[model samples]
Target chain A: MTKPNEFAPAWQVAEAIRSGDVPAEDVTRAALDRIAALDPKVNAFTDVTAERALTEARQVDADRAAGKTLGPLAGVPMAAKNLFDITGISTRAGSKINRELPPAEEDGELLKRLSAAGAILLGGLNMGEYAYDFTGENDHDGACRNPHDTARMAGGSSSGSGAAVAAGLVSLALGSDTNGSIRVPSSFCGTFGLKPTYGRLTRYGTFPFCDSLDHLGPFARSVRDLALAYDVMQGPDPRDHACANRPAEPALPSLNEGISDLRIAVLGGYFSTDGMPEAAAALAPVAKALDADKTIDADGIDAGRAAAFIITNCESSRLHLPNLRARADDFDQDTRDRFLAGAMLPASWYVRALQVRHWYREMFAKLFETVDILLAPATPFPAPLIGQRTIEIRGKEMLTRPNIGLFTQPISAIGLPVCAVPVFSGEMPLGVQVIGAPWREDLCLRVAGHLEKEGVAVAQAPSGF
Target chain B: MTMSDDDFDSEAFIRTMAPSLGLSLDEERVAGVSVFLSIAKGMADILDAAPVPENSLELASVFDAGQTAQQAKAE
Candidate 1:
């Protein structure tokens, strides 16, 4: 009976449990114990389902005794951002308003997929209110602290998802990325995150913020773990009308394929890391390691980013109009103010923004025709302090909330698949987005895998975790 | 849709539109919401300035009833 290492990647953990080196119950208990001990500091898990987790782990053991074939993720523990329903619990979606909603009768589509693939549910993690945030600060559940530095942010709406994985509380986490929710946390927490193409995964059974711009993804310690989770969750669900009518395209099979002849380039101009030395430093190593020398520009980037902001504001505010009208005072001041302003945006502005989105989508479609992958910084800088509001970039002070997503929003606006791979430099780690064309998630993952193998991108645990 | 007019009043727009949309704008939050609206206005201006060729684009539609119905039938 070997002790279960909580910090091991999901692939290794699953292999250990399958080989009888570690019992499923021990692995599950280890994660639960870690969450109980450290979650008070990280504030990652909003709810920990210890009893249910042990029951599920025992079933895995029982199946092994009967010689039944186990799933790939058998005996591995994982958690989802609270936005995903976990049956019998109120899907808080990181807002006080949703806390009063009826408990979900069933799990979300992604959770169900992960469960069927042999992953044990460790309950819901914390996030920003209604997934309408970049920083993981929630008025109801308190700020999700960065695992690296407890005083700083955990990059959110998937705040808990990233923090939980980085803190070794869980092997993998599920998160939603509307405009960098997954990537921001991944960058700040130094985890490998995948924001698959919009419509790549079904959005059914989860609370949504900007329906037009919202995306759901996974965060993990290793690139292979990210790909493994992604492979199982891929497929169309009729429940979510926005989900693409496409079959599952597994990236795990080709994950080891080296980037031999893939045309790679860095996005210049709009993605210029001018005056932001940390981001520039992070991208330089990734570009050099990949032998990527070409620098290209996407003309529609400015318009695309602007369009994302307008569409997000319009759609999210409209979705919460009823609550805004009835319980406006109950909402977080920052979230409430933004939604209120969003509601006032003219329909004409929204319509134009969508047109710009269409234009931007085509622009990327063309850009990918020449290059298989494009490289850019995931965040303009590292994670900011939890309560800090403003940051200075290029000698000009700007709002931290909106500015944090500058690099991420434009890419997600057109719904491209991007993998944010962390590059450990100085004290705090930064991330670089290895972006790919629509539905070419394998390319991004493959590059990330190469970087991980070369030690260029790594998810090193924070000290004393 | 252009925001060329420098005299546009964000507070006035909020006062008028919030009531129309059934959202009550409290005085304290009004100033805060107005600042957000002003930020949104700046972003909108960027979209206005970009030259989007007419023939190459359309609104990115999330729902297509006919296409969805056909896909469901096929499946």
Candidate 2:
């Protein structure tokens, strides 16, 4: 194999592998080599399954020689957030105790689907402990740092996911976004991340954070890669109640259909407020590129964010109660304390929040009537300094961690399909969420792809890589 | 009604609530617990004040087992 595009997007890599311009083993080995050389500084990987990856690569070459059909994602190197179950290793979900659980007997549904599509999993990447964090600083595992600047955060709990993709460590990686886990890192690390509608993809083998809000999706260097990964991973699973009976929906066919005829609108009100100048400034070019001239009011943002907070706390706390009881000392202090707090919430409040969720979803439904897509900032600011605690947003100091999700939480609260598209401004990358009506991830990807084609948005490989 | 800001003392509240959930809290954990509880409470307040139709309670049942959670954003 000569001149393999090691840092190229997954689509390009697949094209190369298919044409015999580059051997699958060469591409896979190149990725493993890069990880060995740079991952120490980036902290993007918790484990690198080099042997498994090469073994899978060998099959691709063998299949081609024997004249077998290739999958859409065939021969691509990828990794998953540590939360997803892989056979023979306990799903870490970024925690000491979780890693102690027995090894999974079978791969999770998502992993199985990706593998069938010919995407080789390099290994699991690092994440926030228990999927309850916004910062990628895992207490058990080391912090996943930004590839653009080692001193900055990659965002979390999908920290390693964002860093790995942005650093070009892999062409594709998977991350779960309950509240901006995918988008936050996408914005900070300059990668494309998708949080498909809740239940759009099966979450059967992944560790749960909140049943109502959890979503499993991908992070990639291009919108097409995001669409390709999502399209391949779409289908139903009997094991995941949320995923059952949902017809397979593919977004790749219309991904480049352009947003010229689509009624794109910028989300205003709560979305426009409290953004730092740099963060707020990033949205203008995206809106201008799409010709987004109209603004829609999102009145229930506060209620939605509040409901998300309550529901996430209550549900996650309940899920971890047994652990909290048996081994509270073993859990991260912040995670344990948050769970304890959720346990203390009144039952009535949780019920009331659920009621409000219905109301919140309706508000978004009404907003979507005249809008095909909504554009909003993905984070209040770019990646914050590692170990830094507070940020000044619109001239007011705010806690860095909770406020990181200020824009993302409201949208995900009601399970909107949002693709976090990166916007470059000099050094660090900021992002905007290309949001669509429920089950309309196609529209979001279309808008993101349109921006990529216009050269208005693109993921820049970090210099550190 | 028990959601009053003045009535909420996080330390005292956790002390009272921990035993029921089989927990023992240390001071280091208290500050973190305090922050989270207040955020949870803040969210509850907004949802409580929002107007809702009488049948809103049953909408979330779709998230239950053997049921399709595919309907009702309530327009």
Candidate 3:
């Protein structure tokens, strides 16, 4: 008999439940018990939702008993970054002030979709304040500790999503990626994450960050879980105006199509791991496995990263302008200073940044003609120690927070689909970004699925989990 | 459009610009805000140096205009 292991992949858990080997309620309760015992050390969950999780799991069990069809993910446990509205709970986008607001009347669209697919909602995970941070440290809620070391950072703004999934409290979780929030945490926490093409998933019922760049996606122990979750959640909603009207093209069925005929290349210039040996080491094996020898550059990436930064600043600052005036003192100092600076940006600069974004997107469109997929380091290095301010790269000390997303910001700026896969090649697991052209998330996930099958990329649960 | 460090002062810009936007900065907050503005200025300068074609347009649409354009293009 297969015993219920919280660390098992979501697909396996679903299969176990479907086979009647384990009850959904038993699995959900085990997850709740794990979170209760481990979350104190990891700080991954902001809310537990134990009662609701048990009720939902019981329904799944009753349905199976009645010969009703079970959904693809019929009883797996999952959580969302706190930015996602959880119906009666206030959406605390990692800020203290938002906690005082009224409870959300409806759950976020993604959460509803996942629930419909029969994934039990464990609760909301912690994140960087207002999703402005790349580091997982938050002031209102304590810094989400890395499960691997516990002393290190969990990466942000989806810190809790990555940590919870990596720590095996949930088989998979939802995270928002606006400038590498999903990828950074995945890279640091050793999990597979997908940042689908911007507007591919509905962002309705989620707290606003930079509307221009925000994307919601999944972090899971395996690429199949990422695709399964993404497949079920794919569709257009009138609620999120940015959501594309295109119908959902399921990536799960085509995940094993393999990359035999597709042209793959390594992103060289801006995506280079110049001073980061850990990232270089992580990418080398994956590159060798893919037989990708061509190193290409996407020109004007500096401008792309810069434009992304400016757009993020201007848009997010404008969104929080009222808060800055009334409750500036309430925000984490790290988030507050950046917003303060963003508010001072002249209209001309914001316009110019958008113009640069257009030009940059054109550059990527041309680059994709030659290659179907691109590979780059998901983060410069593994998770830095929690609260460690600066890190030395190439003998120059740089602020650890902003630099963590150096490779990620440029790609996300143009709204490309990327799958960040954890490679456990060293003392600490590192991640490599399998990037595909706009709307080609299938290619990205397929390549990652290939890597996982080949054992070049794998998400190992943190030691002692 | 490349702003030389000699050409712009982030501290002075914040000191003057914050009030115009109805943002009040405490005396201690000015330096921290300047740090990020300076970083933004550096990035803005990079964007300025990059050569964009004359036809390269900004990526925003007025309200539902983008959605309407997409629908029209599809039809």
Query: What DockQ, between 0 and 1, does each candidate earn?
Result: 0.65, 0.43, 0.51
Off by over 4 Å in 2: A273-275, B1-3, B54-58, B63-75
User: For model 2, how does the per-residue alpha-carbon lDDT over A388-446 read when each residue is reduced to its tens digit?
Assistant: 89889878898888899999999899899999999997578999999999999999999
Mark the regions of model 3 whose C-alpha exceeds 4 Å error after superposition.
B55-63, B66-75
The candidate, 2 or 3, that scores higher on TM-score is 3
Task: Kindly indicate the candidate among 1 and 3 with the higher lDDT.
Answer: 3
* TM-score for candidate 3: 0.97
Candidate 1 residue-wise lDDT, A346-445, digit = tens = 9878988998888788878888889999999999999999989999886689889989999999999989999999998878888999999999999999
Candidate 3 local Cα displacement, residue A233, angstroms: 0.4
At residue A343, give the lDDT of candidate 3: 91
Q: Looking at the true structure's interface, with contacts defined as alpha carbon pairs within 8 Å between chains A and B, what fraction does model 2 recover?
A: 0.73
**Backbone clashes in model 1, listed as residue pairs:** none
What range of 10 consecutive residues in model 1 chain A has the weakest lDDT sum?
A1-10
Q: How would the candidate models be sorted by lDDT, starting from the highest? A: 3, 1, 2
Q: Quick one: best DockQ, which candidate?
A: 1
lDDT of 3 by residue, B1-75 (tens): 455888888899999998888888877899899889999999889888879877656664335545563464454
